[model samples]
Target: MEYRPYKPVNLTAAGRDYAVAMVRRHRLLETFLVTTLGYSWDQVHDEADRLEHAASQTLIERIDALLGHPDRDPHGDPIPTVEGHTHRPAHAIRLADAAPDIYRIARVSDADPARLNRFSGHGLRPGQTVRVGEREAGELTISLPGNDQAPLVLAPEETKAIWVSPAASAGLRGPASI
Candidate 1:
């Protein structure tokens, strides 16, 4: 049997834009899943990723409205604007490098399933305050509010996936009623 290399699809500018728009929709849907539907942090990413490409713009808009125009997704990723504009925060650090103080989770990488799964187990969600307790080698031990008994330890790879801002970190200390 002759072997043939699979050729990847070439995406034009329009196609790229469509792809970004679809990603934006999926991120928004993931936010809804975590905030409204009560889906686990680890469970929503794949579901939203699949749905984002399939859902219509009208349906996405409705979901966005239902989610109350959220700015960030479940994993702290930015939700793309309806106009496709994305406003990202300036400072983002790995949980390992983060100082031992309250800080807000800004963004998280969506490429790694294992990392996301680990974060979910630690209760590390966007808009949640994380305090870095200690760093040993490339691993970080951090604590979340209301979870002081066991500090969550994360590797550098896992920490790099999470972005955060100090100013917004203050918000995580308050009630979750937002």
Candidate 2:
């Protein structure tokens, strides 16, 4: 696609392409940050967001190869395909409505840094199994895979942002499992 600036003349087609490419890189980088580098889910977005626009295609490819071609980022957002296409599955669910038990957190909205931090503090991460213990009007109390005490509570907004997969019996692990 020919690059065209979205609004202000300060933007150029090259700049637009760069921006799109950066966004793509950022999502892929998030996957690497959490899975390979041991970065907390909350810690990767800002750094990746900054680097995405600046990184070379070569660099991004290297990271992608290292991460084994992850399809989703740390927040469960889709990573853009190399050709710039994004394939996102529609599986979002509210934490408040989820049954009280173990399930896999598939994705979360990364728009709020503070919310992401709160999720990480409570041990919520993509692919990790979590047990919902209680549900209030606007919040869900959850237990991490290995933790005994429940320290994670998702507010209505946060709960709405999180996407989960139904937990299979084989995937249940109590606190200390992760």
Candidate 3:
């Protein structure tokens, strides 16, 4: 239980293990809720938050097995393995930082439910391919597959809230798995 003044504290080995276990529980619950229970990405956080504290390890493991050991949640965040290993997408970049090209949606921040709902309304979810156009006036223009090539004008917050990777690098064809 030692910490430096005015510095971010690093977790001890035991603390890290506990944190990882909780994260595993929460993420497994989130994936189960989304994949099995038909819950949307935006709706699983609160439910997972409540359930993570109460869910037993056996239950979480069962849920993970039922999911066929998915490595990512609905929002594309990596799910830690039983050994506490996390595999992050090596090439993921912020949507704001992406060059003008076609890219697969790698991840989206679930921090803002209203914004998440808006994104969902626009059919912007993980694994969806989007065409990133040039940025203008502090906003970025992005286009989906349909919509007659109309661009979705997004503020900086919207752009920063998403993550994308080279669509070709991942071998993701026509909006692959979520």
Q: Which ranges in model 1 have alpha carbons more than 4 Å from their true place?
A: 1-13, 112-114, 167-178
Ranking by TM-score: 3, 1, 2
Candidate 1 lDDT, 1-178, residue by residue in tens: 2234796667777777787788788888888887888887778878887887788889888998988887777767777787777777777766556776667777777777777777777776667677666778878887777775687777777777887676453444433522
Q: Mind giving the per-residue lDDT tens digits that candidate 2 earns over 122-157?
A: 767677777777776767777675577746776778
**Relative to the true structure, how large is the alpha-carbon lDDT of every model?**
0.73, 0.73, 0.87
Question: Alpha carbon lDDT of residue 22, candidate 2?
Answer: 73
Residue 85 in candidate 1 has what lDDT? 79
lDDT of 2: 0.73
- RMSD in angstroms, all models? 5.8, 5.5, 2.9
TM-score of each: 0.73, 0.68, 0.91
lDDT of 3 by residue, 96-140 (tens): 899887888989998888898999989888888888889999899
Relative to the unseen true structure, what is the Cα RMSD of model 1? Answer: 5.8
